[model samples]
Target: MNVSGIDIAIQKSERKTVSIFIERDGSVSARVPAKLNDDEIKDILEAKEYQIFKNLAEWTQLNENAVEREYVNGQSFLYLGRNYRLKIVKESSGIVRFFRNTFYLGEKDQPKAKELFIQFYKEKLNSKIHPIIERYKDQLGVAPQQIKVMELQNRWASCTPSGNVNFHWKCAMAPIDVLHYMVVHELAHLIHNNHTQAFWNEVDKILPNYDEQINWLKINGSGMDL
Candidate 1:
């Protein structure tokens, strides 16, 4: 069904025996509830269909321009291409800290604080990876013209044909091996402009488990929200 151009795929929920709900992605599901006749089911579904359609319509209208920065406190956004749960902590001193699951705020919980956190994380990420980048470059006898960390909404790491490599800050969230694979992935782009069998061979040369790392990014990358 179309809810203001947000097409919804209706499905029967095998898990829920009875009831219906809308998914976060605008899909609707109707659970076959026990003791429900065709008329009752139709009534229930019609009611839910209207409600879901209305909600979807409103959201689609509101989010036509979703990329425009709407920095709301406590609302999550992407940072360094990774998602870090943001928690505002009020303290007298101004200090920002990144931990396993959350970021702590010290007397400075503002939108700029978010930017600062991103900057600070970039610093840490650079410290963590710069040496490795240097080592790999030296070993391969192929130096990237430039190395930089970035926030890319589309791709994780991109290397210009000129050998300038830009990495997503979210790469830091991956495991050390996976992170190294990401670096190697970009480096491979220096040799092969597109994904080909030769490209896979180059990646395998540097990283044996590159396929697993790529799969990890696909499955869990969205969870790394800022």
Candidate 2:
């Protein structure tokens, strides 16, 4: 349903309460009770109009900073919050390597550069993620079955029903501190399944300034791409 110049995706479910959230593409979605009629749905949206518009505006502003990258020489890439200039070389060797403030890539590997970078991200995530998880496992009092990094849309990380924590490889692109926030945020989910106040309190206990990391992702996440 398009309301007041904003497009809202309405989903009906057996769930009792109404829930609304903005997507990564700056779109709005609301899950309503399956029995609600169009009129009732409209009323619910009307009642939450203020919140809808507020979040929509924030999404718009945040996505305005989206970055479009090219696999060309002199392009800049982000690794652990630092900017590194790309240096394309004709020599066929490693697909990507970081050295002396530059990210070196093989010119012949241009077509496969994205895949190589994904592997690089997975490598980076594997190196630090487990240690961080171990650091917080005792505090959160929950142990994950495993940690895996993969490509994901719309979320930075998620906790599985079986207690596995999966993170998006793109997460490796963020600052180490921000990455920690993602780890702790997902770890908190092991104890609480929903984003209730208690869940947030758990996150706060692990990272007091988690809101800053969240805001950082809000503003810069669009640029955290291949």
lDDT of each: 0.62, 0.87
**lDDT for each residue of candidate 2 in 1-226, tens digit (9 for 90 to 100):** 9777768899897766788999886778998889999899888888899999888888888888788888899998888877788889998676688889898889888889888888888898889788888898899899899789987787789999899999988888899999889989999999987677899999999899999999899889988887
True-structure lDDT of candidate 1: 0.62
Residue 11 lDDT in model 2? Answer: 89
RMSD of model 2 against the true structure: 2.3
RMSD in Å for model 1: 14.3
Query: Candidate 1 — which residues are off by over 4 angstroms?
Result: 1-88, 92-95, 99-102
List the lowest-lDDT window of 10 residues for candidate 2. 90-99
The TM-scores of all predictions, comma-separated, are 0.58, 0.89
Against the true structure, candidate 2 reaches a TM-score of 0.89
Tens digits of per-residue lDDT for model 1, 1-226: 4433445444442333444444423355555645566666665556566676776565455444344333343545444345555566666234456667566665455646756656766777788778777666654457788888988765667888788998777676666766777777777777776556787888887777788887665555645534
